[model samples]
Target chain A: MPQTADTNRRVVLSERPNGLPDAKTLQLEHSEVPTPGADQVLLRTRYLSLDPYMRGRMNDAKSYAEPVKLGEVMTGQVVAEVMQSNCEGYAPGDHVLAGSGWQDYALSDGTDLRNLGQTPQNPSWYLGILGMPAYTAYAGLLEIGAPQPGETVVVAAASGPVGATVGQIAKIKGCRVVGIAGGPEKCAHVVENLGFDACLDHKSETFAADLKAACPQGVDIYFENVGGKVLYAVLPLLNAFARMPVCGVVSWYNLSGLPDGPDFGPAIMGTILRMKVKVQGFIIYDSFPPSLFKDFIRDMTGWLESGEVTYKEQVIDGLEHAPAALNDLLLGNSFGKMVVKVG
Target chain B: MPQTADTNRRVVLSERPNGLPDAKTLQLEHSEVPTPGADQVLLRTRYLSLDPYMRGRMNDAKSYAEPVKLGEVMTGQVVAEVMQSNCEGYAPGDHVLAGSGWQDYALSDGTDLRNLGQTPQNPSWYLGILGMPAYTAYAGLLEIGAPQPGETVVVAAASGPVGATVGQIAKIKGCRVVGIAGGPEKCAHVVENLGFDACLDHKSETFAADLKAACPQGVDIYFENVGGKVLYAVLPLLNAFARMPVCGVVSWYNLSGLPDGPDFGPAIMGTILRMKVKVQGFIIYDSFPPSLFKDFIRDMTGWLESGEVTYKEQVIDGLEHAPAALNDLLLGNSFGKMVVKVG
Candidate 1:
């Protein structure tokens, strides 16, 4: 499919990060394009999803999921095309989304491939709204948060994949939705496009007060994806019996370990107890019932078909450029779901 | 009724404790017992239940229940006998349990008195196994823990009233119960008398290791009342899907404030996320349901009658000595429920 035959290109974990990782921590090198055997297909990656969970896999410590081993391909989920297939059901030219990692091409046993069908009007949507990030938001917020009509629901990371879905779903449930993002553009998109009742920018100098002013009716459900100063700001604004679904903690991920600064855990715990709130950290796979997945797919497909939920994607040009894209995502510089167009 | 027309001794809060209260913080005095009104019944304190929850009342901090104000009588659940009655249902010589204070005579409007009736094998048992403490244990452990048969359940302050009942109830539910207590005598009481599968001494140099050995299957439900080194030891031994019903914090009551030591709050948060463990704090009055209270009374009464469960009482001599008894109770120096024999 390419003008040149593909050689190897992979990113390896050079060393565990003591704090935030620098470019020196990741070593990119040329290697052989792995071959496909019988009942296997060679995938040419078209899009790679950069997510907060990738930070967890980069570390060797125990977490909800397994960490990627050193000297291995950095693990990720990607939308790729089958270059050649010697397996049943999957054939050459078929598009699929699989955990293809950060590489130009990967050999799959045809076991993990989910067929993306023949025609995709927006192929990158598979890496955004129709993907793991979307599912994480849908299941965690709807099932756990259980927002009621007239309730005020708030979500941080307002423009990102998970947070966007969370705010949109809360709006669907008839709750007054508030969004918190990093900049004016993202905040504008959240309120105008996502239909949030109000949006606040965390980067604002008066961010905490802005959040408090936006939600005059105290927050009933806070989809907690960020646990830093934003969380501290959100705590006092939380009403009695608030539900906090802990989907991610991107702010602390780069720290390598618990920060040595003033610990905010006590403050959070005290707030939870006093407010009679429930803060539950859930891995989407474990928390969502299979029935939820069926309902999500049906509703989400309809929303996409009807244009009720709009999505944004920031696409990187090539697999060679994925490292920079990942850095931008980790640094919260990328505006939306940052997708690396690998092939 | 005796040499004196009314008992005049009372213990009132003189000064709030900086950490844990001392005898000097409480002032015992001779106060006149006023006559009862048309709807009021004068009660003579028989047995006052010295519970760990009273520690919170000593501080002015907001909690599920209001804190005891300085110069007011120390609040407690008391087994008292009606000396003079002006209400319709209650009369002289009737015994009842009331939320009377640390005083010789208390006047209640008969609005909140729970008539214990005249006959009892041991009236003091109403303050422990047949009382609020047992109900607290039962309601929290069964309603929240939801321990299936064969699950390993652990409880701290094992020889204390609530912990003893918690371990016993879990055993009744067909669980392997491990009890953690302060010393050898109490630990022995937990295993031999309360029928715990195993018991660990918290004061031991090898406590953590001993706890691990005792819970080879890992702890599924930890009835967490005392939160200090005991919680630290239990954290690592907790299995996935562990449930922690936090009914009190007796061990921390002795301190005026946080130790000049490293806080374990962040570590606790990280652990909860990694294990999907649920740690819930509840007050008996706020979250304790009456249906569970009836169920507990029926089951615990049966257990007591059948000789399956036994409790020890640490009775002090007079109402005048209740302040010292309370100070001892808060310090965990009293072996059992510190009751004032105010006959």
Candidate 2:
């Protein structure tokens, strides 16, 4: 069943799901490996990054980025080996960061492909801590949240890549960080391993009360990636002039519609007005400047080397298991950064 | 009643209303005029400024500023003429801006009074165009909204002081300004007199469609004062990186609770995330520094003198009519700035 040069294994969008996506949403098929034309490079994907934003691409709704078309290759970011090259600066056996989709091999024009060079300590690190998730945490917390010393910083999905990075950075900046996670185990990991001041389990029956008890001075900066109950609890605990850098709303991503009423829109708007809160949303690439990435890379590398920052990844074995892994991510069943080792 | 130096007429908060304030909410009573102490100044009220924020002060709920206590004189801003002076910077016939409450006469210990020189073109202008409302528009729009040339700026309560000033300033910045008002007359005034590119009547059956039609390029900045329907309409029309300076939520101020079901909080947050919107709330005095006031005064004075900025006021005749005038303001019945001529 091994793929030859004449055939490639790939996953394509079969159908859009109504709520949580299932096996029927994606179809695995075999196709002829794409041939690289002039100025193009052929890539064999080694590791594929799975992120929450990909869920948004499944819907037909208008967003900052376009949705993945039906029956087309499912879009994703990958760390790949340049198998063959007809373009300058690319050579056989070189690794690269490419948008090679959910496939064993892809053809790139070398236009947007980034050369990761001949060797990396851990190439999979480029898919997590040294990649998009970490960059989102860095730019959003520093640029938008702007946490001052001794301020209270709270973030949801505490054990995940973005949230873990946010909490750790806030600690480095001398702030009290409270993290919200789904289970007691993740909460323990957030506090003991990630250095957050306190971690609350959102699944607890007295979650709201626990969160309030944890944030004695109220929340000054709320790094919002998960919405729903966590957001509702955070709203009341937000201090005056709180800054919220909203990067995702993973909790509601699978829901077909809003929950039942008394509509909380007015309450949210009213709280924002009364407290003078600043709530802003952003995409990592949109706000972070290309020039600033050099600084980010330098700082993050130092932090990792010094053990000031620690990272965890949930590695799924094969590309065919991506659909199930994505479901686990949406349901909060996956820990840390979720990635598929596809080599 | 006319020549009473012995008795002073003052209004007090009788009871907090369930929703909107009525005649029963405030009670006027006569009491003996108190004598001023050594460092105190005695003043007779000239023009009393009635603003929308006073509605928040009437509520028992928590807010940025303290609520007015039951049976205390209803808090307000006033332009008063000094009848007697025992303070260093005050003299007879001096006009000062004071938080003197709704009354015919009051005694000040000179703590929060600002001395306004004897004569000016219009003393009441300090309560509107030259004062808090104008300053709010200046700081919120310029500092937060940051509307650039060729961008579109939208504001609600079109003919009122805050909205009018915001639109005019946006025009001065070379932006396309669209305003939302309650009626045809106010809409006409916003377009013809204030020079807004277009003004939509929120009271119209097709208000949402009309708003979309008016804003062909989508809204870049939304100066939100009136919430409810106006906010709902503006949400979908906001462009990527849209900035919303939430100054007030007048439309929802009188509501006892949130409106019925399928909660829109998730929808609002989702839109914010997808579009990368920035929504911030602010109170004028909290954000603007005193040093910036000098610049604002100079710029506004020049604009007024050059006929680039015009204003309107709905003057109510007596101190007895202040409650009714405030009700008119809350209900959107008042066409412009609501002021009471008390002297």
- State the C-alpha lDDT per candidate: 0.79, 0.91
Candidates in order, TM-scores: namely: 0.90, 0.98
Candidate with top lDDT is: 2
Give the alpha carbon lDDT tens digit for every residue of B1-343 in model 1. 2214555677788888887677667887777887899889999878877787787788787555778888988888888889999988898888998998777788999988998777656888888878888888888898778889999998988888888889888888899999988889988888888899999988899999999999899889988777777887888877766887777667666655445435454456556666667766566666755777787888888888887777777887776677777777776677765677766
Give a tens-digit lDDT track for model 1, residues A237-314.
887668887777777677644455354444455556555566667787686677887788898998877877878888
User: Residue B193: error of model 1 in Å?
Assistant: 2.6
- The candidates score, on chain A by TM-score, as follows 0.95, 0.98
Off by over 4 Å in 1: A1-5, A176-178, A183-185, A197-219, A232-240, A256-258, A261-275, A302-308, B1-8, B253-263
Candidate 2 on B177-228: residue-level lDDT in tens? 9999999999999999999999999999999999999999999999999988
Ten consecutive residues with minimal summed lDDT in candidate 2 chain B? Answer: B1-10
Clashing pairs in 2: none
Question: In order of the candidates, what TM-score does chain B achieve?
Answer: 0.95, 0.98
